[model samples]
Target: MRVFRIAKKQYLEDLSGEGSRLFGGRWNKKGMPMLYFSDSLSTSLLEVLVHLDFKHLTKDFGYIEIDIPDNLIDTKLKLKDLDDNWRDNPPKSITTNLGTAFLKANKKLALKVPCAILPMASNILINPKHKDFTKLKVIKVADLDIDSRLIVDTK
Candidate 1:
């Protein structure tokens, strides 16, 4: 299966998941290493754009295309399986704890979960420490030319 991630140009080559570990995210708590990837490029872009402020938007963004074997994705989560407040901003412990448990269990390389930004779409959470993680390949990395209009202040 193919997955995509949008990040700053310099960080595109770093798959260590260190950034997410240090800052945490919706699914993982601080100190837990997890790589977030979207099933589609648009979803990846949207995931990043939503968290970015117009003033911080820059042209130094890039996209990564990774190939993960289908078998490596052992767990799949649906919206119904999550807490009623799973999509809450600031992230709830219910979701973070669930993800933390998944990482601690260390049974799979990737966990497929619903994207809060677009629930119909999905995101793949990668456990960098997993042994099978080495099997994932970075097939492509290139500049992501985001439209200028997206950063314009309409107000």
Candidate 2:
């Protein structure tokens, strides 16, 4: 399947998930780095906007397209199928193990999805870390669906 990830130009070739681990995201706290991806490009755009700490937006970002065989993904934890409030508060035990495993193995094993609306997924916790995490195909977008002031630079 094809998944999309929006990131800065400088990070276009970086998929180590180290950047995310260093900077905690909405789903995982500090020390946990997950390679976030979305089923929809529009959804990825929404995530980039919402996750930013600043209000204004002038920086340009690129869209990365990844092709991962469905068979390779082992969905150990599916937050989308959960009934509890997985967004505001995710299960600690699961997140902890996934984080620890990712740190050790380097490959993604679990899919941490907070909600279906976001359509987000990450293989940052995969076991037996992948050597070429940044080899995924990428498309630079100079103009997105939103206003130019909001985003630009899609190549």
Candidate 3:
């Protein structure tokens, strides 16, 4: 698949480390026409936005960034190989407040979504750790009917 390099770069910059997005990462007024993320989002979240057909959003789009929830949890698994367990087991319903917010926000966007993706962002680290938060496995592409209520059409 073709990648939007610019968008990818902007996505990474906003989510350099652990932080809260100023305003839900709606647009890229500060970054390079990019999206944003906060602690609530896992790398998987970036992956979701990076992918998917955003043709309607703009042809200037570059990449889809994501936040993978529960990355640190997997890091605690204590695995020898990088792909030890090699499983994509996401928990049902998000537990964190931010996660719920993200789900609700994305759920509204899902109306326009045509599909979903998996980033395999969960894994154990030998030393150090990513933020340890439970992953949220919500319904993909279930809310594609993005109307005025779900998301405000700024365009």
Q: lDDT of each prediction vs. the true structure?
A: 0.90, 0.54, 0.26
Candidate 1 segments exceeding 4 Å error: 153-155
TM-score of 2: 0.62
List the candidate numbers ranked by TM-score, top first: 1, 2, 3
Residue 44 displacement (Å), model 2 = 0.7
Q: Pick out the ten consecutive residues of candidate 1 with the lowest summed lDDT.
A: 146-155
Model 3 residue 144 CA deviation (Å) reads: 23
Judge candidate 2 against the unseen true structure and give its global Cα lDDT, from 0 to 1.
0.54
Query: When superposed on Cα atoms, how far off is each prediction in RMSD?
Result: 1.7, 5.6, 15.3
> Candidate 2's residue-wise lDDT over 36-55, tens digit each?
77766777777777666434
lDDT of 3 by residue, 1-155 (tens): 11111233333333232222332222111122112222223333344445444434333333332334332222222223224222222322211232334333432211111111332332111110112222322211111222334233555
lDDT tens readout by residue for model 1, 58-141:
778889999999998965677888878889999999889988899999998999999999999999999999999889999999
RMSD of 3: 15.3
Instruction: Tell me the spans in candidate 2 whose CA falls farther than 4 Å from its real position.
Output: 26-29, 53-55, 79-83, 89-128, 131-145, 148-155
Better of 1 and 3 by TM-score: 1
Worst 10 residues of 2 by lDDT: 119-128
Best-to-worst order by lDDT is 1, 2, 3
